[model samples]
Target: MPTSDAVLDPAVAARLTRDAAGLVAAVVQQHDTGEVLMLGWMDDEALRRTLTEGRVTFWSRSRQEYWRKGDTSGHAQFVRSVALDCDGDALLVRVEQVGAACHTGDRTCFEAGDLGAVVGAGA
Candidate 1:
């Protein structure tokens, strides 16, 4: 796990610990279009991969591997910026998406509702 040499502020560290098992949720979004691309999980490795590779990579809970979002589907998400929520248990990854963000041939995993309706539904 990555640690800062600087002392961690308790408030910040507390906020970052909602995922007690060392995992967090990452929401991928299109940087230019502002479209939500996909949702995935991240372990420390996944986070490292995204930061290091400059692409969206996730830890598949079911597949139990590090999954690069578009490795197979060709719907690559090129990361733009990563933001952590106030709680820090979740992340928002803005990216420059290449193709369809969904495996089902859709633009985004969140193609159902408008932003107003799904604000708190957990991205």
Candidate 2:
């Protein structure tokens, strides 16, 4: 994996724990409704862009490039806030989602992924 020399706040970078590919998992959510929108990966530079530019940017693992949300789809995610997980291996990106978060035009990626697991008796 190529290292990023892009500028990111030292303090924020220090808290990150990336994977072997030098990427962190980002969980995108609707700021107002708390609905999980989608999942994306981010390198330091992508994270910096998301934080500084007020838009969500992700490092595409397959395409091996950076893509800003809504650039082509017009389904943008306007950033509200971001929080690093306790383990520093993940991030929660809160945004004002404009349209479908899924490439399939679904509201969320998880919307159609229910496995029908047996419900456990729990409070």
Candidate 3:
């Protein structure tokens, strides 16, 4: 159920499937390049803000508050588009990134060396 302060569209909210914590995983990407940037979490309020405010907003699980990207870091993400995954439990936020997307000043959060895995053979 949406909170008392909910402002999300009813039709859109009805399609969501929030976790026990009322959050959906939001995967952010570079709008034009399609580079995967980072993942954030969002509750209904955060999603609503991101959709309407032209900036990416996230629900901070650690801080237990709402945070707008690039507010303090100056690495703002301007929302270009947002899409809910088929399951309605995840979100894809395409943005015009201003600076590093990761908190560590990296371009992407997946910058750590990849774990060795068997290469897949395409059909």
Find the candidate with the highest TM-score and give its number: 3
Candidate 3 stretches greater than 4 Å from native: 1-6
- In the range 1-123, model 2's lDDT, one tens digit per residue, is 345667889999999999998899999999999999999999999999999999999999999999999999999999999999999999999999988999999999998867999999998
| Colliding residue pairs in candidate 2 | none
TM-score of 2: 0.93
- Put down candidate 3 lDDT per residue, 29-102, tens digits, no spaces: 99999999999999999999999999999999999889999999999999999999899999999999999999
Can you tell me which runs of candidate 2 are displaced by over 4 Å?
1-6
Tens digits of per-residue lDDT, candidate 1, 28-116, equal: 87877777778888876677678768988787778777779878988788878988887778989999988888778888877766667
In Å, residue 79's CA in model 1 sits off its true spot by 1.0
List of clashing residue pairs for candidate 1: none
Report lDDT (Cα) of residue 28, candidate 3.
99
The 10-residue segment of model 2 with minimum total lDDT is 1-10
Residue 121, candidate 3: alpha-carbon lDDT: 100
* lDDT of all predictions: 0.76, 0.94, 0.94
Off by over 4 Å in 1: 1-15, 18-20, 112-123
